[model samples]
Target chain A: MFSKESLDNLILSKRTVLCVGLDTDPAKIPAHITGTTKQKVMEFNTSIIKATHKYCVAYKINVAFYEALGMEGWQILFHTAEYIKSHYPQHFLIADAKRGDIGNTAERYAKAFYDEMPFDAITLSPYMGIDTVAPFIRRGKFAIVLALTSNTGASDFQLQPMDDGKPLYQKVIEKFSEKFGRDEIMFVTGATHSPMLKSVRSLVPDYYLLIPGVGAQGADYLTTLSNALNASGAGVLINSSREILYASSNDDFEEAAAAAASKYEF
Target chain B: MFSKESLDNLILSKRTVLCVGLDTDPAKIPAHITGTTKQKVMEFNTSIIKATHKYCVAYKINVAFYEALGMEGWQILFHTAEYIKSHYPQHFLIADAKRGDIGNTAERYAKAFYDEMPFDAITLSPYMGIDTVAPFIRRGKFAIVLALTSNTGASDFQLQPMDDGKPLYQKVIEKFSEKFGRDEIMFVTGATHSPMLKSVRSLVPDYYLLIPGVGAQGADYLTTLSNALNASGAGVLINSSREILYASSNDDFEEAAAAAASKYEF
Candidate 1:
């Protein structure tokens, strides 16, 4: 049972909160690795991971990359996640999988992302209310719900006020945070939403936030962090995936990646 | 390349609308299947698929069964969906993976559910707003959003009024039907909400509805169907799992399953 304390400690000791985003598109995978399929994905991820393990505290494998390729993709995803767990066991692992459903339906989702995939945490959408989210925040694993996301379209409704005068996302964070969620719950805030981080920090003063949209998504680290944390100073899992992973395409790719990761230390 | 039209026609011709829920739990699987490892899941699902292909119109393999066991669970999930798809090529295959996310994130989620898994449709939650849904309804793959769930807690917020003075679920269906959706978007209306079905029907008259909460969950099919159908003769995909798949522990399991599947006509 990899606890949240363990993840937080890993993040602390590592000094690098970079969740190496392995959203590897096959075509974008180094040319040598493309045509070989699953094994190639594994080999490709292995090199990148091995090279940058010293710099990152987490590895976030987007399930879509593997799933899009069918069996080969899934095999690669499993192998890739397994490789990360076995090799960099101390690093936080997140199945960048956004899964949510009904209670019975969510039970299976919890199993897939938490139990089967063997990731420390999984991304979740809190749309169908607390029941849809309860399954993911079970015993050991954490469920990172989609709050104010990094994407440009988030403001369309996530920030809109509900009939109760609370914004929809605020209702999500406040309501869902109360349901069976202790340290197990986290939120996805974009680095781009640095402006709203202060209000968000006031709302969810304690829960961890898995912030995307930093690095290649053009979110500034210090500015975003300043807005995310409350009086507690413990709730920001600042994630920078793309810019860190592809910091350089040269033979010194790993070094470039490490440098990029180092740029976001706590 | 599996068109929604092909799936619809097959469902129409077969006179069955049952989406066989394959929520496989390792403890529940008969011991005759090997160890509780990945192989057993794959093997058990294969056997179930082979034995019950004749009776089902669609195989809804809830992602959790495989996910709970970890990597092996997903492998089983992938192979099972592929196996069932190959075995019953005409049957509509759904990943019953209720997935939704913010827009860009939703695109990745969509690829994972639709492109990667190759399921004809995938379940979703619309609480995040229509922007969160558009990606899933891309091109031809149908998006089954959770409209009004069957759970006791569905009343927690789904029926609450939006700013527009419409119930949240009604607004969701109406908004979904008018926006980026046509016939490709459907709703997951609980058969337990039989009386409320007509309201759902009147709201989105042309869209399909995947009605679960039958048999084991306790919803009368005929009554549910009568309420769910609009004047267009559309809507209603009644799903039954544990009640059908495990209808009997004896050798008559598949037959019992067929009997259950027989209950749904349109």
Candidate 2:
């Protein structure tokens, strides 16, 4: 359970709002790690964590890359989460799973991430509505709903003009905020949509926003920080995946990852 | 890839619109299996598949249940998919994995289910927009998007009235239908919302609907069939999970599951 106060304390003490995204791809890793896909991914993750943990406050493990590998991939996911929890207890951990279903199914997913694996937060898709998300918001765990994604496809339903003149994403943020407080709920607002960050901040000024698309996806960090920063100067966790994880394909990949992470310091 | 014509042919040949949901829970399986979580789940799934495959045309595997057991669970999931594909290739396999993300991430998920596992179709959440869904609609594969789920939480967002004098679910159906044809896409409309089936049918009059919430969820089957059946008399694949999967807790569980499944025959 990463309380708002504790998250803020980490942000202030670490002097960084960076959340390293472990979107580890087996095809992209260096040729030096001659092992099975699971072994290579785990080794890569451990190295990256060892080098970058001091520079960032959180680690976002994208579930898709692991899911691509089948059962072996899932083992890597569990090991990675366990490694983070056991080694860096102070760092907030997120499973960037983007999962939601019916009430019963949602409960199982919540248990998978929160109880079985012990992640502090899991990203959720809000298409199925409130009940799909309610199961994730317990005492300490948080459900970060996708509001404005960084991709071009976000304009499909999320940016549609509703009857009230507000875009659909605003309605999503507003409705979710009504049910959860700053600690239990967060919104995934992409860095590409940095201009809209002010609008998002206006709606839920105190809530934490997990901003992605900063590095590899080519979103301006200065613009995002200018609009998304809250009164506490600690309301957003900017995630950089490929740019930091695959900083170099050489022997100094871990050192390169750490150097890239340090560039995101506040 | 389940073509509209082939799927319809199977529906007629099987003489039923039933899809047995393999939501195999380790805690719910009969004690006689006496195996590890992964082994027990695989055994239960195999038994149920053998018992009920003759009565139904499709098998919907809810990914969350398998995801709960970590990597071992995923191996069971793969084996289950393989069992159905090898022995009952006629049966339409739906990976009830309600997954969607950015375009690149969504592509990996599609490859995971379609290329890696050989599921005919995969359930998707459309909250992120068109790019999130376009990756899943390859040659023979189908992307069944969640429009109006059968859960109580559907009221939270899916049932909300849009500015165009239509519920949000209707808007979702309309937009998706415009982009993908009936062959490439399907919609998940819960059977519990039987009254809305008429409206949904009217919207996507030709597209197949993967309707859950029958049997155990207390949805009236006759009403659902009457409202959802299209001109071809094959427009819906009704999914019932718990009612059929856990029909008995004793030695007769497999026989009971078959008997329970036979009752849904049209």
Candidate 3:
């Protein structure tokens, strides 16, 4: 069970809140890793896991890269999650698949990630409302809802003012936090939105925020950490994907990933 | 290209706006035709497509059910889409995956569904903003954004009042339609929200709306059709999943599905 206590313990022990994103692309990986795309992804992830397990408390596998490879990609996804669970029992595993659907479909998705694969958490899109999110929150698994994303398109609707004067993203965080507590739910506040982090923190201070866009996306670590950190000084999982995963396109890729991860250590 | 003309031709030719949702669950399929879960799904989908092609103009395959079966399930998804393209070339195909992410990840997702697979349209969650959705909208493909879902949870966020006195869903429709025309983008408005359909139609009268929650979900067909129809008299694809897929749990499931689908024919 990936409760708040378990996450907090990991944060304390690891001395860092880095959640390494394994958004591995076959074309981006080192040419030395031979074989099918799935095999190469598996090898790359395994090496990275072996080398950088100590520096990070969580591993977020982006589902898009896997799905792009077809069936073999799904196999790699299952294998990756299973590998992490068996090898690094202490680490939190996240399926960074921003998925949500109607009630029944959502249940099947929950079963796929939470039951079938053993991810401790899965990123969810709250556009479909609470029912789409409810299925993913059971069995001590967390559903990290997209709140204030760091992307340019976030301004389209997320930052739009609601009738109550708060932004749509704020309303999403408030509603989700109210329905599901900090344990069952978390918010994805982009590192690019460092200024908005305080506003988000003010709404759900107790809930952990899974932040992306720190390393490669050019979000400042100190600003994000200072603004979004909670009362316990541990309420954010700062993710760095390409900056760590593709640190070097060479045989020393694993060592480079470890080094990149070490730099994010708090 | 799944252009307005292509859709209009199908609607006129078929004389119906029914989009049979292939939310095929391995467990829910008939007991007679059996094999591995993936094979059973493929068999079931193939039989249903053969049986219902004359009644419905489109097929909406929910990705969650296929993803639940892992690697082999993805093969079935590909097979199902391929079968439709080969056999029923005139019919529209939608990947009801409800996927979105940052720009890079979204690009991979677009490649998976639009480039790698032959889906005419793919559903998108708009929470991540435009960059996440923009990648999916390309030449001859459609990005159907979630406006207001049929679930009870729609009240949680979609129906919330924005500062302009319009609900968030209205804002979403307005923004997306402004950026992308009726040809490139569509909206998913639930059949249950019949009254709200008028408001939605007012926002984007010409654009197509994918209406689910009919049949098994107990949404009134006439009410939805009356309020949501466009100037062409064919502006909605009323999706019926369980109602058409599991019309009968017996050996004659395909026949029953065909019969159920015929009921929705104009």
Interface RMSD of 2: 1.3
Tens digits of per-residue lDDT, candidate 2, A118-182, equal: 69999999888877899898887789999999999888788877777777898899889998899
Residue-by-residue lDDT tens digits, candidate 2, B148-186: 998888887788776775777888998999999999999
Better of 1 and 2 by DockQ: 2
TM-score of chain A of each: 0.92, 0.98, 0.98
Pull out the clashing pairs in model 3. A162-B162, A162-B163, A163-B162, A163-B163
| CAPRI-style quality class for the chain A–B interface of candidate 3 | high
Ordered list by lDDT, greatest first = 2, 3, 1
Clash count (model 3, backbone only): 4
Best by DockQ: 3
Tens-digit lDDT track of model 1 for A1-266: 55546666666676656677887765555554444677666766788888777877777887766666765566677778788888777777888777776787678777666655668888877666777777776566778888887765576556656687766677777777777555678888777878778887787776777888877788787888778754545456777666866677666766777677766666
Question: B1-266, model 1: which lDDT tens digit per residue?
Answer: 43445556666677666778888766665656666577766766676666566666777878766666655555676677778767777777777777665565677767766655657788876756777777776565678888888887677567666676666677667667777554577788888888888888877766778888988889887788778754534345678888776766665655666676666665
DockQ of each: 0.44, 0.73, 0.82
